[model samples]
Target: MNFNKIAAITITGTVLTSTGATLAQTTYEGDEFMGYASTGEAVVVTSISGYFYGDYSEYRDFTYTIGNDYIEGTALCAGGGTKWIAEGYGEYEAQSEATLNMVRFVCEYEGELQ
Candidate 1:
């Protein structure tokens, strides 16, 4: 094969490979059901905490959107008597069918984390 033709073919294959990897990391396909809540089911709280088995735990806040309806809440994890925070979005096609699509999550930490 000529040098130019071989180079072009290598580049095309690299591009396709990278594109597939990107999609695989960002795609989700599965069914995971976790209970359900009725409308107008909410409570006021000063703070929230949960038990997570780890030395470090992150608190994630999730935001879901479906047409005109949307839901937003915090994802909490407690460990080492302290809370860490990490933020990201969710991508699950089946979840969109059940309720709103979880678009994103953002978290902020206050005080010093132990």
Candidate 2:
């Protein structure tokens, strides 16, 4: 197996598999409690819009250190019909105006700032 010790054991197993994928990145390195503010209260915004749903994602520029003023609202489908215009911060988002089968992002971010 001596091809220079099998090329130094294949370069030390490719540097320990790239340092165990950078220590197994779990994404949102902020220790997600939904990043703060939004508690275990669960979510909802479906006063009638076909029971809403959610799943919006954000991390760009990454400044969500916990802003309770989680603004960016305006999605009113389920009869009132306004359906998404501003979203992305934290707490509640991902209720895509009813395509059903489930991506459920019925939305709310006002539960933060406590």
Candidate 3:
């Protein structure tokens, strides 16, 4: 093939790859939360603090969109005092003014203390 054709193909491939990566996942850090969003699911880490058992603990919220509906929940971690890591899952209800109703979700999470 000609050099021009090869260059065009290379550029097209690069653009496609970058676009797919961008759509697959995104992450953010804010004053109150750190979060990441994937194709159908999102995770928000809202709080991290010292706990009785270990140096730190983590609390997270999550959301997953399904069609026109969505599911949301929270997760908490209670450190093992020495291992510095923990895992837990829970369900909760959230109020959305737009929907004028309550939504419930189940969440599972794991974290390590810094």
Question: What pairs collide in candidate 1?
Answer: none
* Highest-TM-score candidate: 1
Clashes within 3 Å, all models in order: 0, 17, 1
Choose the strongest candidate by lDDT: 1
Please give the lDDT score at residue 2 for candidate 3.
19
lDDT of each: 0.27, 0.25, 0.26
The regions of model 2 sitting more than 4 angstroms off are 1-67, 78-83, 87-114
Of candidate 3, the 10-residue stretch with the lowest lDDT total is 98-107
Off by over 4 Å in 3: 1-54, 66-68, 79-114
Give the candidate order by descending TM-score: 1, 3, 2
Sorting all predicted structures by lDDT, with the top scorer first, yields 1, 3, 2
Candidate 1 on 4-90: residue-level lDDT in tens?
211111211332232211111111222223223233222221232222222344444434333334444444433221222222433
**Angstrom error at residue 58, model 2:** 26
Which sections of candidate 1 miss by over 4 Å? 1-33, 38-54, 65-68, 79-114
lDDT of 2 by residue, 1-114 (tens): 112211111211332232111221111112123312233232222221221122213111111222343333444434323234434633433343221101122222212222
TM-score of 2: 0.17
